[model samples]
Target: MQTEVIIVGGSFAGLSAALMLARARRDVLVIDAGKPRNRFASHSHGVLGMDGIAGSDLLKTARQQLLDYPSVRWLSGEAVEAAVGADGVQVSLADGTLATARKLLLATGISDQLPDIPGLAERWGSTVLHCPYCHGYEVGGGAIGVLGGVEGAAAKAALLADWGTITFFSQGLPITDDEAASLQQRGVQIETTPVVAVQGEQPQWLELVLADGRHSAQRALFAPALQAMATPLVEQLGCRLVDSPLGVLIDVDAQKQTSVPGVYAAGDASVIGNITLASAEGVRAGVGIHHALVAEDSRPRPTAG
Candidate 1:
């Protein structure tokens, strides 16, 4: 199919970007595989004007609202490869179909490489969660646990303490003298034992076993998921990625245009903010793509030799 812009990953970012392009009367196609990282969360918070809404429902509403612009088309499919062309780019789909556009936006998003702890996946969106601001308040005033992941993760324990009594599980993560003193000053429980597994299936609170093989209980648990960039399409297009707090992210200029001429990235694929942040980024990216395309449109034609 022919379009002015092709946006991959149709959740918050892709959809929001598409909204702007569509409003500007551009023929935009959104190709999504329907796998959103936030699919597990029942309600999203901290997003201005969208607090207390389910993640899936918010996406559904965005897609429905996009229908007002007939220029936008939604497709439920995965994008596999992208190739640059004189006009713009050609994106290949998993089903062997081809789509062409003058510019490309990759909202392809990322995946959390969760540790191989049993029952974590099932409780991921529920009682066991990430992002203290997003999920902490709901699970507040209860016994909370933070599993040590990489270095500097002890900070997460202190952050969650605002909502409840906090515990730092340094399983195999030896606490230094200073860290122990800090926990004592803050009334935080310091457990240095390895977490054998979690107990309960629904809420699935961690049944943290201590070094002495004793079980320390927590009503709600927090563990940082190991995150990796979801797509190389940006790298394939030569976008330079620089240091980002969450990890490395594609470097985009003021227009959300990557180092590559006609490529853009938004949402979790580009920013590590919450859903509200993702949507806002997506809208900005969409507007940026519009200006980029307009500039290319208005460029002068070369004189015949």
Candidate 2:
């Protein structure tokens, strides 16, 4: 089916952009696979007005609101592949359905690759967490642990000191002199023993099992996971990708337009941010797409010779 705009991944960014296009009375189609990066979290934080709301509930309400527009459509399927043609862009779904649109917005979020520690995966969004700003306050100023593996683990530990007593577990990973100095200045303790596993229950309580058979109990563990794109559609569409400290992300401009013309990206796929920033980027992409379409329609045509 043909549409003015096709938004793939109907999470925060996709849905936000679709709302704009729909408001403009553009025929917009949002294809979603029903998986959001924050789906694991029981409640969302740091988002204004909707603070403490469950991620699923917020998305449910947003989806309902977007669908109220007459010009908007939603598809409950994954976009397996995408290609840009002379006229526009085409997206192929997993079920082999084809969708064509003059412009495409990619809000396909990212996936987190957790550390290979046992029991950690099960308590991920509940006790083992990322982004102190998102879940720190709930720690209740208790003992907090930071697992080392990803870049800037020490810095994260130091920053999280304001939330609770921090212990930086190097896990045999080397820490720089500067990092050590900073940790000391921030009153963050350093534990070089490798973490063999995590034993705990939900709602912010954990025990880190050290390789030497020692266990350290803490209110919560902050471990940075390696992030990867949730879908291969970016590569399939030939959009430019850039490397960030966390992972590779799609390259976008001030207006959220991707390297490929008529293609735009937002949310976790294009930038490392939270729900608020993702929604903001979505709004920018939506306005950018709308203006581009208007310009294209208004361009003067050559008279017959």
Candidate 3:
């Protein structure tokens, strides 16, 4: 299929970009794998006007609204490969379907790699979390725990203290003296014992089991999750990759255009994970793509010689 713009991954970022292009009467094809990074979260917070809404529900509504435009089309599948050529950009789906467009926007999002602790994965997005800003308020000023091993764990623990009493578990990782002092200054308690397992009821109470046969109860555990690109499409297209504090992300400009010409990236794939930031990046990419397309279409053609 051929379209003006092809958006891979139709989650918040892709959908937001599609809406903008659809309104501009541009033909847009969005390929989605139907698995969003936040699908595990029962509710999405910090988004204006839609605060505390279920992440899935917000996506469903947005998908419906975007599809209402005649120029917009949604494909439920995975884009396994992508390439850019003089003609345009082409994306191949896992089912062998090929989509070509004048420009490509990668909103493929990211995947969170949780620590190898028992019971952690199952309770993720509920009792275990990554972003304090997104899920902190609901902690209700209760006991909070931070599992170590990720970069800047002490700083994270200090910041999380605003929400409640914080317990920073070192998980056997070394903490710098400065970091330890800073954590102490912020009234954050440091626990050196490694967290062997997490136990809890779904979406409510949680208990951390230590390796030394100790258990600590808490309302929620904040563990920094290592992030990785959800798809290899970014590398396939030769887009420049950059390292962020969280993980590797596709390098993009202020307008969300990737290093590769005619290719752009937005959302968690390009920037830090946040619903509002993802949507905003999508809007910027949409406008950037539209302007690029217009400039290309308006170029003067050479006269026959």
Candidate 4:
């Protein structure tokens, strides 16, 4: 199928882009795999008008709104591969469907690679959380544990200081004397032992079982070692990527256009992972695409030789 724009990933970022382009009268097709990174979180916070809304329900509402714009089409499928040429960009799906478009937008958010601690995965998004701005307020006002030895771990613990009592589990991560002093001043307890397990459930609370046979009770645990899952599509399209403290992310300009001319990216794939941030980037990308298309069409034609 041919379209003016093809958006891969129909969650927040993708839907936001579609809303802008469709309202501008552009034919856009959104291909979604149906699994959003935030699907595990029952309700999303920090989103201005959408606070306390379930992640799934928010997407459902966005998709329903798109029904008012016939120019936008939604496809439930995974984008397996993508290629860009002088003519346009072409995307392939796992179902063998081929979609071609003048411009391509990738809102495919990165996947988080959680540490292999027993019981951690099961409690993710509930008792276990990430992003102080997103989950901090909800899990605040109690004893909280920040896991990981990375550079960002201490910073996370420091940020959560005001929310509640924080315990910084170094997890075999060597902490310098200064880092320890800083955390101590902030009322954060430093635990050098690694976490062997994360036990218990939410509402009832949880326990951070350590290797030293000491279990620490916490209202919630924060982990800071999120990594982006590798995707070959970006490489195939020749988009440049930059390694960040969080993980490798697609390098894009202020307008959210990637290194490739006709390719754009938004959401967790490009910047800090947040629902509100992702949606804003999507709007910028949509406007950028529209401006580029109009400029290309309005360019003066070359005179015949």
What TM-scores do the predictions have?
Answer: 0.92, 0.97, 0.97, 0.95
Misplaced by over 4 Å in model 2 are 302-305
What does candidate 3's lDDT look like per residue over 235-259, in tens digits?
A: 7989999988888989988889889
Consecutive 10-residue window with the lowest summed lDDT within model 1: 201-210
* Candidate 4 Cα lDDT to native: 0.88
- Per residue, candidate 2 scores C-alpha lDDT tens digits across 33-108 of 9999998899999999989999899999999999999999889998999999899999999999999999999999
- Residues 1-305 of candidate 4 have per-residue lDDT tens digits of 99999999898898999999999999999999998989988899988987889999999989999968989888998899999988999999999999999999999988888888889888989889887788889885889899976777887788789888999999898887778788989999988889999989575799999998999999999986566844568878889999889888999998889999999999889988689889998999999899888988899999998
Colliding residue pairs in candidate 4: none
Clashes by residue pair, model 2: none
Candidate 1 clash figure, as a count? 0
Show model 4 residue runs off by greater than 4 Å. 302-305
- Candidate 1: tens digits of C-alpha lDDT, residues 206-250: 565555767777778888776667876766677788766456777
Worst lDDT run of 10 residues, candidate 4, spans: 224-233
Tell me model 3's lDDT, rounded to 2 decimals.
0.92
Question: How high is the lDDT of residue 10 in model 4?
Answer: 91
Output the better candidate (3/4) by lDDT.
Answer: 3
